[model samples]
Target: MQRDKFLKEIENLNHPNETLVPTHCSYCAMQCGMNLRVNTSTNKIIGVEPRYDWPVTLGKMCPKGVTAYQQTNHEDRLLKPLIRDDASLKGTKEGFREATWDEAYDLIVKRFKELQQNYGKDSLSVYGGVSMTNEKCYLTGKFARVALQTRYIDYNGRFCMASAAGGINRSLGVDRGSTLPWTDIHETDCLFLAGSNTAECHPTSMFRIWAVQERGGYLIIADPRETPIARRADVHLDLRPGTDLALANGILHLLIENGHVDEEFVKNHTNGFEETKQVVKEFTPEYTSQITGVAPEKIIRAAELYGKAPNAIVLFARGIEQQVKGVDNVSAYINMALVTGNIGRPKAGVGTITGQGNGQGGREHGQKADALPGYRKIANPQHVKEIAEVWGIKPEEMPEAGVSAYEMFGLMEQKTIRSLYLLCSNPVVSAPNSNYVRKMLKQLDFMVCVDFFLSESAEYADVVLPTTTWAEDEGTTTNVEGRVIKINRAQKPLGESKPDWQIQVELAERLGRGKYFSHLKTSKDIFDELRRASKGGNADYYGVTWEKIEKQNGVFWPCKSEDDPGTPHMFLDKKFYHPDGKAKIFALPYTPPAEEPDEEYPLRLTTGRVVYHYLSGNQTRRIQFLKDMSPEPFVEVHPDTAQKYNISHEEKVRLFTRRGEVIYKVKITEAIRKDTVFVPYHWDFERAANILTNPALDPISRMPEFKACAAEIEKIEVKKVQ
Candidate 1:
């Protein structure tokens, strides 16, 4: 009866004048299923309705997903290409003038040729983002290496998913965000989430988390802040910022001492356990408490709960992965799942809370500086030969690997890279040390940006090309579970805006690289090429046709042939991805942050996302509803810290670091640590938390320590009127 009533209510939601087009949301990796309501006569996106048939999210939608359709016809949408003639107004919105596509293309081609001719091919760089479809990301790599012949190409994922990717690949020999399907989450006996704020970041997955606890399963959380999920956890290991490595090592030590080790499994299917065991031997609960600031009793409870469960899953996000030893932290947590024999089966494994819409697939295809299609390494001769054959070029024609995303700014400052082609990202607001990043961006000789709106970063562009929104394009994206899903077109392109794929193809034609890209006339054409390019590689997508995706709801990767079903649960036969078919257990030592708290800067400052905004607040902040909900950023201060600084709630305070400073309204609460302060990094300019963030990169992942830095807060004195 309940099922029938739910079906009836869903049927009642249909409108007579609107057509419901099935698609996915444009925000985070949850990729919540939604049906866009399109006006029948006008063919414009009107609103959105829940897609109850999709299995991953069911009918669930977060606030961002609910209002995603509003972005299609937003008033701030860029309707034409812009050209900035006045160099003095580079960082402001006052210098751009409307221009034709031909004018923009001519200017971009001329400038690009002059730079390459004078300063060599490596002078050009392409900085991209993962929010785009897999097709665009794949093409972006080919365009930079084959069309422009430049080696400096990197994406925004370096700052977001690189640490998780680095750790998972090193241990398991393959990088899939999740080892098990999302449907198995609720059936697990225990969930140990580290450094992730799931309630705000990936809210659609909360139902499954809550269902686990409701079924008498345990939930443990590790974070500096007492987040909403932490408040309800069986054990909240409120560790200090940048100390996740110590906390994870302590739990692993306890798990092993308590006889939770699966001796038979480790002896047969794993290597390096003895070495790892020796490294964590000194990380006792008492020793860990001294470093992480969490009680030893809480650490014991967390280990016991996880070790006693019959089936368990370990999950994490940027909080732990944004530190100087982020890769080490990830591997330490993965050690827990491996030691407990909780993986390679249903209701058990490890997963990452992917932050972007296509974070999984975007990294797989090629946007990273060192990668190729199918996660192939550019330095490998065999990998280069395979991709060269696919692109109809010689293996030697492929350029060597370049630096990471943040390092590209250093190259720009040194005049090594004089031009840039940026898309789908707003680095001026997102990158650490915003003041320095802005200065480097200004130093570039020429820059072109492709986006739907004039983002804070786009204001400095010489040419800004208008691009269509997700509702106006058709492509595929890999969700958080490593499931390959389709994004359908709900409406036609608005105004003169085009899709990023179309823009790139057209630009390639103008740059005399027509033969390589002109063959791809549509998104499906690009996908066909992508399938062939990814053949026989790690992230094989050869068998995942659009028809197959529609039939299977969504397909997991490594589907090699048309008859082959996708891999839903990885390592099902207890066979790992290493050459010897065995997973690795790494022995990583705990390392503190590059910039620890000092006497002068006595507080630890951490930054993260809020429930009301997405990365950089480029699109979400433009929406009326979301903007009203979170108009600006604020600093979260503990009561004791506020009292120590003589600050009060809602009062403005200046938060500073060695890099820069920003004044934010104080929000006093007991949810945060007394020695730490928290700020959201969604706003831009003076309010951006990146202004105070440290740019110390992890040696392995190249991920900056955006979560922890030395900071100090001061109360601003008010002046009395004379």
Candidate 2:
């Protein structure tokens, strides 16, 4: 097999002595490929060169990807371990002292052992991040159960992908974000994007959407705010916040009533269409208009466009998923796909616009609270047995799933889970009702955070260990299209930092669970184990190998063997993953947001991300260019709403909700709805939008409602110069 063509072309840019390393971005699920311009003399990564030949992104780097390498040399990069003093640990005053690696490790192991001995194994917990490589995520889950013998483990992916995952699994047989490759967008007649600011959040991915639009394909955007994507939409339905269910139901009703559905395909390939007909019958355009704030005519037009299109794909993201009825919101979208017979085919299906870097694969592995590797359910006895056998442990030795990420923190408040091992995630700023989450974290008996930067979440940890970022690590990351691509190490670990998997392996050895972890000598070793563990599971990787990745661009999952080329698009045979090989449809009804506007709280608050920063501003905040682009968090207020509150452009406004309150500088614009205010949730404690967000969870998915809450804005009084 020949080497990748991009590698050879990049040789000219790098010095004769220096190396150019290939790796996927650690930002969004798009996973744009880039090569680190390394200086062999200094052993430093000076810059990033786009890897144009990568299959998913085609070398297009978002703002986040271009500046992501700067974090390695960030001034605030955590270079040493810090052990909080007794006073700081007790919340008396802020204090932490630098300590040797051995000292920090001994303290962590000792405290963990004491907690394990006194409060039982379930008392220890771990919280992972989706940004981590597949190897690190797998090892994190393994360490939590095998090393500590604890059933309390979860990850930040719960908050990001739980709703999408649950919806996809229930409606279809499986839950890979995209049923078709990104290139399929060009072949579609239309692209229905709801609840996703595709142009800003996934800048590189927008090229695919643009390709469709350029070819006379229609664009339908449904969102509360007029994002960049919405401005250019063929039909932009500026729906009210948290009303995705109603809008989707209305669309389904219109499609079915207009006879735009493929009746023959529905009868042959799907079940539950009759039930959906009955449920959507009541969601007429007139009724749904009252709830969703979209005009009756606009809703009908959107339905007509999406329904009439011969080939189209519907995509949604956090705006739809981060709500109290997130699962139903997703179900509603899928229902439309079913009646329209848009699934299990080329250029037609439901896809989730996953936000996190590995949002799709991150949830597939056992890092989640209620899953084993390969996207297998923890409740399934056969799945438990299979994974247990692969792990070299008795099925009985394995415990049931623990509480989710949010539930784990709540357990801490109840004095149940006393120890928390947080790696690669910063829940203090990312979690809904974060003010309370911070308090719950402080109540933990022991807390250890592993990260290269001293993030807001790590500031409260009892011990903080500097861990290497993606630039200094070698592993595999699954992209939005379900392609697993190998990421090579570009530079050595800076200072005393270590890769996250190495830290977990070393910590496990210290915990006396060394024998089971001995086989994991490298990221590849762990990857091979993941392949064996996932052989017959949902996200089968047994067919993929590192050597194979070098030969091909990247391999998609369900690859049966080394000779297999791997499937870029799934369900081409029109067969679902269900027992009867048929897709299931939901007859979901509309439900209003958990918290709606009222006399006391007359404005709806919606939170999202800006183009420049990633989640929680953990790494992006350190990048000078990104920080310069977006200096601080600001609220987007409609001119009508701002006028009522007596707030002007760039003036500070106090936005209050039932959960909490904060004062953010307001940017008055007509881009937002008069009934709602929008804020980016990337700031710290003083201005974090999550502080005022509700923690109401979707019963099925357990995802928090971060998008909609009863909120009111008031102008902040200016102080005199005196």
Candidate 3:
């Protein structure tokens, strides 16, 4: 029965397999839809044209989206599977050699079986990425437990949105980004951005940002650097690194003292209001100014602007999330929004600026340490029974939740997990304390990586299997607003690469677990079962169908049945999903970063992204145009700090942290605070920012503090040319 179902679905598959296939960009969470101009005769991606009718961006796209098609035909794309060359026979002593798909699959199954028998099932681990489609993520987690039967599994979204998820789950009873539709941003009367430089990171979202200004709304930006987006704000509170929680407390304190809080909403729809009010009483603007580097007047001014606005939003990104106090930082922002009665309405709430392609959908459909498909809990017996039934397995067949992303690597150092399987991520470059992470990778008994290119992390693997790219596959990804949209295939797979789903299914077939996975053929086939698995869960998609997504631009989730219209705005009835139908207002206190500045390491080093590249620069850096725009790594130093260190603009300098140091060319600017230095975290190998970042994680979120670490600078004397 299962084999027949798989064959039928594969025979009736739908995706980017032909000319003019409609798909979305695979870069950011925006997921702007575009049509691939393909030449079916030669099965080549010719060009890209905007799908202007889609409401998300109105057909507008960033530079990356326009040039994304070039990657399909790029010369450097992997044409075949590559197995690590043995010491006896090889062109390069320690590199890979071309191999057939069968050879790659044989190596994977043989090594994994040997390791599982010797070190036990727990020795094999799986680490996935947020860029994968919802079906792929769910299948990866299931494959790990059902096929490998290992308890270790997680994804890269842990580094992107785990803190926000933790904060929202505890306070609001749910964790979907921007509970309202994407159009709500246009209706907001005031918007505050913390740690996010949206103008550069998500350029397509500018339509909503400008809409607020066009309607005379106020904008406030809080960051150590005055980025291009901050320049547009009415008030820019350039706070010191690791001071986000302090600044949020100060804003709320001012709002409460000025009688700006919505007392009615506090009394009826929330818990812990009195406690939060008591805590913010001591966070005056002056005290906040001493902690954060912002002036007292600016804090008060920004608070007043937001407090007076009828509709407001509090937006944050990795700047606030990638920290030791990440959850506390996010809870503070949510506290302010709830206190002002800014959410549960048209355009007032908290929204996370997701960084990865399917970060939203990835987290919603399992792949996290403690989560199951449809955001179900691993410990919840009812959720387990329902999902187990869908997969034709018993409730006990599912494994328990494992450690988080960073903790998984820590286990590798202990040799607990001997085999490693990575999908769609380059953790060797992106994980905190990457030098330590690489050492952990070297400790693995066997490693396999599935990706379109030989990424930095993949370069260390025993077997590298090629997978289909965005231009040649079809799947559905939920955008930042929780809208599920379909991406159609534009052309046939290049060379011998297959879709990620096919790879997992075939691997399962080879491992003697074919019965459970035989039904998953096409993405839609997997989605059909996913709908049944997700039924009655928070991220329910029972009513959504491939037919609906193709007919409409996209549909929002929690659409319970076919007759039910999609939910565009969450909590429209002003009731949260908490047990008592009321949201909780947390009274989180301000705390300093795990590592602080001292006399020896006198400056704070913070890392971030650039307009020309995305995370770790595995894909964007390969593109010639993007590389040309932002070539090489440089540190942004304040003019005053440069003088103190005897450094000049465009001169060689060394930034030293307790962990390590890297040489970078200095670019002096007044836009940054004198005590803080900003370095883009895109480049890898010798130029990666994670090389100097602290791995101290949030107790609740387990997110590393990549935003703030203590460091100092020294001028590297450059010799003149003869």
Candidate 4:
């Protein structure tokens, strides 16, 4: 009956004048399957329909996914290359004039050459984002090292997924986002979600999360705000922001005291348990409550629920991973699963809720500063030699590793990195301490932005190259589940805009680096090279051919050869990737936020996404429906805090931190901690939450502290018009 009903729904979506092109949503890592309705006569995408056949998000589409098609044909799209004639108008949208591709490429080459000749090759830098296909990301690393010959190449994932990557890699010795597939989520006996607001951020996955509860399984959440998912959780540990380490340790202590430790698993499959136990022994519930501000009883209850479950999965997102101790927080949570022996099997493991579309594949294929393709370290000589062999360059010619994304801005401030090639990101709105980021961008000797829209960051560029949307490009992206799925092209490039891969190829030729890139004429050509480049490394994809992806719906990696079916459940044999074939349990110590609440800034401030917006609101803000749903940013304040500050609901208030300040309309709600305020970081300019966010970097991941900072709200006095 369900199959027949699904067939009927598909039949109703069919139209004689339109052809349905199957693909995945170009938004979050859920990568919900969808079919783009393309007008056959015009070769343009007209609408979108949910892909009921796709197993990950069967027929489910979030508002962003439903309106994703609108981005390709939107009026705000950059139709031609833009050249800024006046250097004085760098931070505004006033100086750009439409130019041909030749003029734009010539100007970029001339400026880049002049900068490199004047101040060494390291003057040029590449700032990338992970929203693109794996093909584009792989080529981007090659483009920077081979063509540009620069050591200052980093990506936006530094702010989003770096901590999760660092933590998972340290604990399990491999970072695949999720150990068990999304299909295993519903069957899990318990779920301990830390810092993720799955209901709004990845709405399509809610069905599976809710299904766990429908089966009488327990759900535990740890967050500062009572998010939609937290409201429904059996236990909500509303800990103070930046205190996830303490809360996780508190739970670990109880798990040990209550005799929940799997002694056999700890003795065999893991190491460092004795040291970890020693560290957590002092993290009693009362002591932890003093640090995290979550009740002792709540912490004990959460530990009991998770420890008692036969099969459980631990998951987290930016909330815990966007702090100074982000990596520690991640490992602390994974410790729970490791101690409970709830990993290395079906329906049990640890995973992260990936924030971007290709967060999994993008990080793997070397967009990061210190990473080579296949999660290989650039610092390792053998890894450099391996990648150099594929690029046909001598190993010595490869540049050394660069700094993280935010640190690149620091280099720019010092005039070390004079030029920047920015793509797939809007740092002006997304980066922490964005006011300083914007200032540094304006001071760049040469700046180029490649994006479909004129983002806030693009407004500061000397040249803006038009790039095609996802619907106009064909490639592969690994979903949050680490499944490599093919994204089919639904339409040709509208106007003169080109795909980012083609743009880089053309740019490389102009810069006299054609031999390394000219052979890649199509996305498949690039993917074929990428597959070989990724062979034998941790994120091996040599066997994951386009044909295989199409045949299997999607193929999970570390697929080594053609006959290999791919790994869906990681560490199935209980063999970890560490040298000793054992997962590590770190003895992490608790740490406070870089900037805690003080006399001047007396409240905790945290930032996150809204259902109506993706990162930075570059694409979604242009869609009328998404814009109408969330027109501006607001600060969520507890009623008691609002009253104390003499602020009223919907009243404009000044929310200021040590970095900067923004005026937001008050949204009084008891869903948030009385001592904390929440702001969605989607809007740009003065409304952006990044303005108030701290730029303190995590020691291991170099992730900026976006989730917690000291802040204070002031009631704005409106003067009468008279």
Query: Model 1 Cα displacement at 98 (Å)?
Result: 0.6
Per-residue lDDT of model 1, residues 1-722, tens digit only = 74786575466467576788999999899999999988888888877889999998899999899889989999999999999999788888989999999999999999999999999999999999999999999999999998899999999999899999999998888999999999999999999999999999999999999999999999999999999999999999999999999898899999889999999889888898999999999999999999999999999999999999999999999999998898988888888888888889999999999999999999998889999999999989999999999998899999999999999999999999999999999999999998999998887899999999999999989999999999999999999999999999999999999999999999999999889999999999999999999998899999999999999999999899999879999998989899998888888788888888999999999999988899999999999889989998999999999999999999999999999999999999999999999999999888999989999999888999999999999999999999
List candidate 1 segments past 4 Å from native.
1-15
From the highest lDDT down, the ranking of the candidates is: 4, 1, 3, 2
So what's the TM-score on candidate 1? 0.98
Greater-lDDT candidate between 1 and 3: 1
Error of 1 at 49 (Å): 0.4
Candidate 2 lDDT trough over 10 residues, lowest sum: 86-95
- For 1-722, candidate 4 gives per-residue lDDT tens digits of 74786575467466677789999999999999999999898898877889999999999999999999999999998999999999999999999999999999999999999999999999999999999999999999999999999999989999999999999999999999999899999999999999999999999999999999999999999999999999999999999999999899889999999999999999999998999999999999999999998988999899999999999999999999999899999999999999989889999999999999999999998899999999999999999999999999999999999999999999999999999999999999999999999999999999999999999999999999999999999999999999999999999999999999999999999999999999999999999999999999999999999999999999999899999999999998999999999999989988789998999899999999999999999899999889999999999999999889999999999999988889999999999999999999989898999999999999999999999999998888988998
Better by lDDT, candidate 4 or 2: 4
> Tell me, what's the RMSD of every candidate?
3.1, 3.8, 6.1, 3.0
Candidate 3 residue pairs in clash (backbone atoms < 3 Å): 15-489, 16-488, 16-489, 16-490, 17-489
lDDT of each: 0.93, 0.87, 0.87, 0.94
Q: For residue 234, give model 3's deviation from the true position in Å.
A: 0.5
**TM-score pick, better of 2 and 3:** 2
